[model samples]
Every structure is written in C-alpha cells, then in structure tokens.
Target chain A: MLRNISVEINGKRILDNVSFEPNRGINVILGPNGSGKTTLLRVIIGMVKKTEGKVSLKGKISYVPAEFFSAQMKVSDVMLAGSRIELNEYTKVMKKMEIQGLINRDFSTLSSGEKRLVLIVKSLVEGDVVLMDEPLGNLDLANRAKVLRILKEYDKTFIITSHEIEVLDFASKVLLLKNGKVLYSGNPADVNESLLSELYNVKLRRGKDGWSNFRFDF
Target chain B: MKGINLIFLSLLIISFFLSLVYGQVYVPFDKIFSLHGVYKTVILDIKFPTTLSTLLIGICLSISGAIMQLLLRNPLMDPYISGTASGGAFGAVLAYYLLAFNLPFSWIIYISPVIAFMFSLIATGLTVLIGRKTGVYGIIVGGVVISYIFSSLITVMITEMSIRFPQVPPLIFWLLGSIQIVGYTDVVILSLLALGLVLVSLRYSRKIDLVSISDEMAYSKRIDPNKFRVFWIALVSVIVGYVVSQVGIIGFIGIIVPHILRRFYGGNTKSLILGSITLGSTILLFSNLIADGSLGFEIPITAITSLIASPIIIYVLVRRNAQEY
Candidate 1:
C-alpha cells in the first residue's frame, strides 16, 4: 500500500503524489517510456527510497527487474540464494517455468530470455506480493503467452509494469500511469481507448480482439 | 568433493609435520610426540606455536579472501584489497614509535595490535564509502589509493625509527612479512579469530551467493545487501588486521589461495569457504617451512609467495578477460 508516495533521485522527482493498492490478482501498470513505471516498482520493493510519504507493505516481497543482471555463478545457486526456502520448492517453480534444465549451467552463459525466466522462477518462490518490472519485455510470443498463463494461474498478488498492452485482458485491474501520476485505476474493462490515447498522447483504437492499436494522433 | 577434501587434509597434515623439522634444530619425526628435554621444549614451546600460528593465519586470511570475492563479486578480490594490510601495519608501526619515543614501556607494545585492528576497520569503512558511489572497480581503485597513502606513511616512519636504533633490523624486516612466535597469546588469538570467521562465513554463504547477483534481488528476498556487504567486508578486515598485527603482512596467501580453490574445486559457497581453509592451511604451512628452512639463515615468506603468486594473479585476470569476450 502506497500513500502519497513520492521519490526524488539526485534532485528530479521520479514518482510524485502516487497512492495505490494493488489488486490481489494481476495488476498491470500501463504507461509509455519514462513514465516512472520501473521507479514505482522499485519503490514498492524498498529498493528505491521514497523521499516523502509512507508505504505500508505486508508479507514478503520479491522482485524481478526488467534488466536481469548476470553474475558469474551457476543457475542452481542463483535460485537458492538468500533464503532458507527448500530446494524442492524452487525446483518445482523452475520446472514449471521450463528453466529446470538450465540449473547446472552458468548464469552468465544463459540467453537474455532464459535469464528473465530464471529470475521469474526465483521471484515466484520468494514473494507473496511479487513485483515484476517489464518481465515480458524481450520474450518471444510463445514465452510471453506461457508467462501470462502462469500469472493468470497463480492465486497470489502481482504488480507488473509493462508497455505491452496486448495482455491487458489477463490483468484484473489496470493503473494507467503517465508523467509520474496515476491517470486511472480500476477494473481492466473500465480502461477504454480514450484513456489510453490520452495516457500515451497518441490515437489508440480498440480492436475486435480486445487489443488496442496505437497510431500517431498528430 | 569428498576426494578433494581428503587430499587437502593429507597435504595439510604432511606440511604441518614437515614444517616442524626445519626450524632451528631438526627434530626428527619419530621424536615429535616423545617429549623429554630440549627436544621437548623446542618442539612444544617454539616449533608448535609457530606452526600453529602459520596454520591459523592461513585459514583466516584465505577464508577472508574468499568472502571478499563473494561479497564484491570480483574474482580478483583479496584480503589486502580493502587496505587492511597496509593500514594495520601503519598503525602497528605508529604504536612502535609511540613506545620507543614516549612510553618505552614493555606492555605498550601489546597495545600495537589493538590500534592496528582499529585502523583496519577505518580503512575498510573508507573503501566501502567510495565503493558505494563507484561499484566493484571503484572499490579496488579506492583501496589501492588508500593502501599507497598508508604505505608511504609507514616508510617515512620506518626511516626515522631506523636512524635512532642503529643496531636494530632494517625496517624492511617488518614490511617484508615474517612469522615469529610471540607466545601462547598469538596462538590463542589466531585460533579464535580463525574459528569465528569460518563459522560466520559458512552461515552466510547462501545469502552471499544471492547478494553477489544483485542488491535488488537480495533486498526483495528479505536480505539487506548493503548490510551484508559491510558485515562481510568488516569481517575480512578484522581477520586481516589480526594476522598483520601478529605476522606483519603475508601477502598473496589471501589472493592466491582462493583462486586456486575456485579453479580446482569451484565457487559453490560450501566448497569456497571450506576449500580455502584446508588448502590455505596447507599452502601457508609449506611457505613457512621454506621460510625457516635448514638453510643457514631465515628468508621472508613474502619473498617466496610474491614470486609464485604474481604469475597466478595475471593468469586469472587474463583468463577472466578471455571468458568475457
């Protein structure tokens, strides 16, 4: 729970006057580039300090950053880090995420997409409220679908910030953020074309498949 | 892994026994346990303490090096990389001058190590502060800078001291690194520090593995990366400080031992700390034996270690660069 949360890094305000309560299901943060989406996720996970306001968070929080860092280590050790969590539980998540086979290999040698999947598996086992920053950014279409399916299936709460609006239908609630402010927050169905167009400052058309097509409004 | 552990144990035992033979009078292996007269006093009082201190310093410094590497996520990190060696030496030397010029009290010399330990922590804190803004390479740079400053100050002090005590050993003796038996106190202190370091390092090994990946990941998983980094860095500093106060400064053992283990054994947390201890004890024991050989006079341990470790450090760095490409 973020109440009037604000952050100033080096001087410039990254997030300002933003308050939100993430839904128990998938909560998608829809915004364009530099909309403070990543900063918002970082703040929630206590990675980025908030200069002003209070954030009361409950339960364990695990995070998977958009840009995965590769350490010179084996994949299995990466998954087993920092927690007394059982190896069996981590392996179960790894298998489900289709990354169990990469366990013996060096993490630095894995492809970017593979690295993201490993981080996802790590977050799943470690967090009650998982915060993912663009978890699906570089993934292929098949992997994207598989991850969305996993998010849909997992009963726990998740807050994800992504530019990919095609999967918006899978998310129960949507928070359209722009210029570090919350423009709209409610059920995903309530987010219409007009709101997205204003949020992205481009003409957006609602297509028949529940996907909105973005076009230059100018 | 089991086989490797067994081999290391055998090497450690062999070196420990062999080290007893070369110091001053040659106590044959058969008479080692059979103590009666001068042989008993030499073996028990003199040789035993020296060899035990050597083994303890190896265990402490090597594990310290391994922990620094894991915490910093740099394979090149060593116990000295935090400036503890130079800073502590400077502090000890400062204590020496204070005693000679001002106090001249016999007990004042005992305070030397305590002052050295304080300086070691200060050096690590400074490095960590610089590292926060700069990253791993920055930490290295910061540590090197701090080391040079301390080294120059120590050199100046040594020159001044040598002018007064003309009959004393060249100040280089303190700088070159040597292991001498001070008393049972050295043995007891080294053993306690070594044991404490090993146990704490093992307990935090898993979290360290995660922290090595990224601070963000560690934080979200309920581990404070900053706190752990400082904790481990301070631990390494204290271990290095304790050893430097006792044995002057034995370089390369910290850096060389960990890399050797990481290559032959691998860097899983358990293997890293454990392998460093066993192999570290063996290597230092061997080096000590060579330093105090059957030769006419004693040679400094660093003279032998630096010659061997210099090439290994270059090889590890070059191989790492190759892997990166």
Candidate 2:
C-alpha cells in the first residue's frame, strides 16, 4: 500500500502523488510504455527512492526485475545466490514448474522467456509478497500462457505490472495508470472500453464476449 | 582438492623446487644438503628467501586482482589498472629521496612499505572519490589517469635524484620489477601479511559472490554492496602496496591468473580466489625461473609475464568477441 507516493528523478517527476492498495490476490498494474509502471515497482522494492510517500509492505518482499543479466553462472547457482529457501524446497518448486532440466544449464544460454520464467520461479520460492515488473514482456504466446498458469496456481500476493491488456483477465484488482498518475483502481471486472481507450490513447471496443479489441483492423 | 586446483598445486610445487635449483650457479637439489660453502649460502640465504618473496608477492597481486574484479563488477580489472601498483612504485621511489634529503618525517620514511601503503591507499581513495558519481566505467578511467600521473611523478623524481647525486647509478631496473628482498625478514613479514589478508578475504567470499553481479540485486537481497566494495578496495590497496614495496611493480600475473582460473570456477568467488592463490604462485615462479634461467642472466620478471600473459589475454578477448552476438 502506498500513501501519496511521489518520485522525481533529475528534476523530472516520474511518479506524481500516486496512491493505491493492492489486493490480497494477484493485483496487476496496467499501463502502456513510459507510464511509470516499472518505477512504481522499483519504489516498492526500495530500488528507487521515493521523493515523498509512505510505503507500507507486509512480510518479506521478493522481486523479479524487468531487465536482468548475470555472470556466466549455472541456473541453479543464479537461483540460489541469495535465496531464502533450502535446496530441497527449491528443487521441489522447480519440479512443480517442470523446469528441473534448466537447473544445470547456463543462465546465459536460456531464451528470454525461459530466463524470465526462471527469475519468476526464484521469486516464487523466496518472497511472501512477490513484485514482478513486466513479467510477461518479451514472452511468446505459449510461454506467456505457461507463466499465467503458474501465477494462477501459486497462492500468494503478487503485484504484477503489464502493458498487455490480456493480463487483466486473471487479475483480481487492476490499477490503471497514465502519464505517471493513477487513473483508476478497483476490480478489473468494473473496467470498461472507454477507460482503457483513454489509458492507451487508442480506441478499444469491448466485444460481446467481454474481450477488448483495438478499433483498427490490425 | 579438484582436478584443476590439484594440477596448479603440483605445478606450484615443481616450480618452487626448480626456482631454488636453477639460479646463476646451478645448485643441484642433493648437493645443497651436503655442501657447506657458498653454494649452501646461495640456496639457503639468497635464492630461498627471494623465491618465497616472489610466491608471497604473487599471492598478494592475484588476490588483489580478484577482489578488484569483484568489487568493480568487471572481469578485466586489476591492481595495475586501478593505479595501486604505480602508487606503490611512486611511494617506494619517494622513500629514496626522503632518506637522501634527510627529511623531517623520519619514522615513515625509514620503512618503505609504510610510505608505499600510504600512497597506494591515497591513490585508491582519490580514484574512487573522483569517480563516485560516474559509476564503474568512470572509476576505471579515473584509475588510468591516476596511474599515468604517478608514473610521470616517478620519472621526475628519479631524474632529479640522478642530477643531485652524480655518483648514484640509475635505478631504471627497479621500474621493470624484480624480487629484490633485503633479507629473510622481508619474506617473513610479507608471508604473514599476505596469508592473513587472503584468509580474511576468504571469509567474505560469500558476500563477494552476492555483491559482484549487480548492486541492485545485492541491495534487494539485503546485502550492502557499497560497504563490501569499500572493504575490498582498502584490502586490495594494502596488499598491492606491501607487495610492490618488496618487489617492484610486477604486472600481468594479477590479471592473468584469475582470468585463467575463472574458466573453471565460473563465478564461484571462493574457488576462484583459492585457485588464484596457487595458480598465481605457479605462474610467477615459472616467470621467475625464466627470468633467472632462460636468459643466462637476471632479467626483469615483468618482461616474461607480459610476454606470456599478453597472448592469453588477447585470446580471451578474441574468444569473448567470437561468442558475443
């Protein structure tokens, strides 16, 4: 939960008096590029200093950063670098993800989606409240589905940020952001076509099936 | 314990023995035990201490390199690159003039290592201070500039010293670096200091591993990377200072030993540091052997290290290029 959070970098306000409370389940922050989604996540994790705000977080917080690159290390070593869990527990979690084979592979050898998934797995095993920034970014359709399934099954608080509108389907609560300010925060089911069209600055039509579509044919 | 470490250990041992025997006058291993003359004195008193000094210096430098690399998060970092070696060299040369001129500060000037350590620490402090806001790449560039500044100062002082005392022969050879210990006392002091520092570094190996990757990652994990980096910078400065005070600035061993060992260790700071210890000593011992044996006369140890390590470093850079997209 944040109370009037304001973040400024180099005299430019990146987050302007933002305030929102995440739900107990998966709470997703939906925004387009340059909408300060990553900054808000970083501020929560204490990676970025907030100029003025109060951040109240319960329990241990683990984070999956949007961009990560490591030394030429084994995947197991990368996962266990500063992990809070034991090896057996970590192994069990990896088994649940069905990515046990990835443990022996070099971290740099993995594809982008696999790397993100591995980091997600690392955070899942580590934190009570996991904060992920653009977790589904750069992922293909199949890999995106794989991650969505894992997040759905995991019984924990996840504060996830995404530019893609598809993430709203599984999100219990949604915070709509535009130009570094919160536009709306409530149940995702309450969100409508006009609000998203304003948020993305593109005409989005809510079809009869309750899925949104861009006005353009593409 | 492992294959690579065991191989390096064996090589270190063999080179140790070989360095003892293959000096100016070849004293065979068996002959030294029974001979009770100049040969015995040469092996026991002169060659033995010098060999130990080289080994200790090697340990100091390679460990310094490993620490710098981890602290800066750059694999190419070394004491030489961070201005520590040139700073120590400048301090060592400054001591000569301080004594010759009979300066007011008597205590520190009397001991070269004390003054050398002081200057090296100051150099590192200045480098970090200047580069504080600029990040890692800035610190590296600052170090290079500082190194050149010290090198120029050393040249100016040496020239002034020569002009003042016409009888004094040029100490140009010292700039090239050599294992020139005063006696066994130098070896003993260096051994205790190097061993203690290396042991202390081993205790922080886990912390080093955590902080070496990225500052944000370390901060997220609740490790203070800045504190660790400062501790390591001071540690490397002291190690480099003392080593250079004993043996004039030897290069390449610090950079080469850790780079070669990293292929096997792969981001394991403990294993990389431990391997650097043995591998550094082995490579330096062999360099010392070539310095004393192959040329039929004593040559600067740096000459051989540069010759051998340049190709290895070039190969590493080329391989890195090949692998990158």
Candidate 3:
C-alpha cells in the first residue's frame, strides 16, 4: 500500500504523488516509455527508494525485470540463486513454463525470450506479491500465450507493467499512468477512449486486427 | 567432479615431495624420512618451511580471488587486479625505507608487516568506493588505475633507496610478485586465517550465487547486496592484506585459478571455493617446483607463475572471445 509516493531524481519527477491499493489479481500499470511505469514497480520493491511518501509493504515482493541477463550460471542455479525453493514445486513451475528442458543449460547462453521466461518462472514462485516489469516484451506468440495462461491460472497477486494494450484483456485492474501521474486507476473494462487518448497523446478507436478488434488509433 | 579433487591432492602431494628434496643438492628420496644426516639438515631446516609456506600462500590467494569475483560481481576482481596487493606492497616498502632500512634489515621486519596490513585495508576501502560507482566493468578499470598509481610510488621509493644503500634490488621481487617469505610466522598465521575464512565463505555460497545474478534478485530474497558485499569485502581485505605482507603480491592466481576450475567444475560459489583451494595450492606448488627445479640457480616463484599464467590467460581470451568477464 502507498500514499502519495513521490520519487524525484536530480530534480526530475519520475513518479509524482502516485497513490494506489493493489488488489489480489492481475493489476496492470499501463503507460508508454519514460512514463515511470518501471520506476513505480521498482519503488514498490524498494529497488528505487522514494523521496517522499509513506509506503509500507504488507507481503514479500519479488521481481522479474524486463531485462534478462546474468553472470555465468546454469538455469537451475539461476532460479535457486537467491534462496532454496522447494525443488518439487519449482520443477513443476519450470515444466509449466516449458523451460524444464533448459534446466542445466547456461543462463548466458539463452536467447532473450528464453531468458525472460526463466526470470518470470523464478519470480512467479518466489514471493507473496510478485512485481513484473514488461514480462512479455521478448516472448513470441506461443510464449506470450503461455504467459497469459499462467497469469490467468495463478492464484497469487501480480502487479505488472506493459505498453501492450492487448494485455488489458487479462488485466482485471488497470492503472493508466502518464507524465508520472496516475490518469486512471480502476477496472480495465471501464477504461475510456478519451482517457487513453489524453494519456498517450493520440486518438484511440476500435480497429480490427485479424479475427479480433482492439482499441487501435494509429 | 570427485576426480578433480583427487588429481589436485595427488599433484599437491607430489609437489610437496619434490619441493622437499629438489634444492641446492638433491637429497635422495629415501633420505627424506631419516632425520639424521645432511638430508635431514636440508629437508627439515629449509625445504620444509618454504614448501609449506608456498602451499598456504596458494590457498589464501586463490580463495581471496574467488571471493573477490563474487563480491565485485565481476570475474576480473583479484588482489592484484584491484591493487590491494600493490597497496600493501607499497606500505611494506615504505615502512622498510622509513623504519628499518638504516638499521640491520631484521630490525624493520616487525614494523613492515603491520604497516602493510594497514595499507592493504585502506586499498580495499578505496576499491569498494570506486567499484560502487563504476559497476562491474569500470571497477576493474578503477582498480588497475589505482594500482598503477601505487606501483609508481613504490618504484620511485625503490629507485631512491637504491641510490642510498645500493642493495634494494631484492625489493623488486615484491613489486613483480613472489611467494618468497622472510619468516615462518607469517605463513603459519596466514594459513590459520585462510582456513577459517574459507569455511566462513562456504557458508555464504547460496547468498553469493543470488548476489552475483543481480542485486534485485538478492533484494527479493531478503539479502541486502550491499551488506553482503561489505562483509565479504572486509574478509578479502584481511585475507589479502595478511598474504601480501607475508609473501609479497602474487598476482593472477586469484583470477586465473578459479576461472579455469569453474570450467571443469560448476560456477557455484561452494564449488569455486573448494576447487580454488585444491587447484590453487597445487598450481603454486607446481610453479614453485619449476622455479626450484633449475639446479643451483633458484628463480622467484612470481616470475614462474606469470610465465605460466600469462599464456593461459591469452589462450582463454582468444578462445572464448573475451566473454568470461
């Protein structure tokens, strides 16, 4: 939980007076680049200490950052680096993510998408409230679907940041952030076109893509 | 691999045996056991002390290197690379010039080690300060720059000392590097500390693995990277300081030994530490063997190791395309 949390770095406000109480489901923080989506997630996990506000976490926080790279290590060791997780359950998680085959492979040897999946798998089972930053950026069509499946089936709370509007379909609660401020923080179904246009500085309307239509205003 | 351990131990034992009898005169292998003749005099008096000291120095340097790799989260971190040894060397030489150079050299021995230890501690402080700013790649640059400065200072002092007494050539051994010891006490004390520190280091193997992956990962596990770093940094300082003061600065063992071992063994911190102690001791012992093998003309152990390691490092870089760092 946070109340008026603000983060100012070198006189530039990265997060300005942001307040929110995240619920136990998919809470997506949506914004374009440089809008402080990453910073907000970092601030929640104590990675970026806030300059002003009262912030207190009620549960343990784990992170799966957008960037994925590690020093020389096997995939299994990478997952178990922080502390030992229950092996039986961890193996199940890896299998579900379709990464059980790469268990003993070197982490540095993995492709970007593979690295992202491994990081997500590690984060998914690590903490009470996992915070993911751009968790689906490098994933392919199949892997992205695999991620959505996992998120939908997961019983724990996850706060994720994504620029992909398609993610809103699965996001129960969406926070529209713009210019370091929260433009809208409520159910994703209630998000309006005017609010999105104002947030992204572009007009948004219903557009068709293949079999499905999405909010697309190019 | 259990086989690797057997190989290292076998090599260590062979090196010890060879070191015991390969000095000025070959004391026959059979003469090693009977403590009664010239064999006893040579073996018990000189060879035994020097060989044991070399092994101890090897363990300390190797383990220090391994911990440094984890602490700095950079494969390049080592006592020599980060200038901790250089700082200690400068301190030792400076103390010798000021406190004991005029007196019989034995008189200054007491003060040099203490001052060297203190200076090495300061070097670690500087390394940590610079490392935090530079990240992984820049930390090596920072350490190398700092050490170069210290090395120049030592050179100037050495040149001045040569002008005064004309007998400072021996001191150059410290600059280039050596496991050459002046006394047995330094080795004994260093070995004890090394043993304790190695055990303590093994305890943090899990946390170190996390810390090495990413600071954020470590934070998630409730382990503060900075706190773990501070503790290990202090450990490396004390270990490096004591070793440098005792045996001068033996470079590359910490960087090269663990890296080579990591290829054969895994990259986990526990395996790295264990492999380092075993292989580290064996490599130094073998180097010392080669150095001592030249009949009637002994060479500095530092020169031998550099000659051996420089080629291996170059080979690694060329083969791996410089990805290990």
Best by DockQ: 1
TM-scores, all models, native as reference: 0.91, 0.88, 0.91
- Please state the error at residue B298 of candidate 3 in Å: 3.0
Q: Write the per-residue lDDT of candidate 2 for residues B49-94, one digit (tens) a residue.
A: 8889888888878888877776676656688777888898888777
**Candidate 3 residue A158 C-alpha distance from true site, Å:** 1.0
All candidates: interface RMSD = 1.9, 2.4, 1.8
The weakest ten consecutive residues by lDDT in model 2 chain B span: B165-174
Query: What value does DockQ give for candidate 3?
Result: 0.56
What clash count does candidate 1 reach?
Answer: 0
Q: Candidates' lDDT values, in order?
A: 0.80, 0.78, 0.77
Return the TM-score for candidate 3, rounded to 2 decimals.
Answer: 0.91
Model 3 lDDT tens row, B180-207: 4444676678678878878898887878
Candidate 2 has a TM-score of 0.88
What are the DockQ scores of the candidates, in order?
0.59, 0.40, 0.56
Per residue, candidate 1 scores C-alpha lDDT tens digits across B67-159 of 777777777667566677888887777777765665755654587777787888788788768877897578889987887788788889889
Residue B170 CA displacement from its true place in model 3, Å: 2.6
Once fitted onto the true fold, the runs of candidate 2 whose alpha carbons sit more than 4 angstroms away are A83-85, A206-218, B32-35, B104-115, B118-143, B165-174
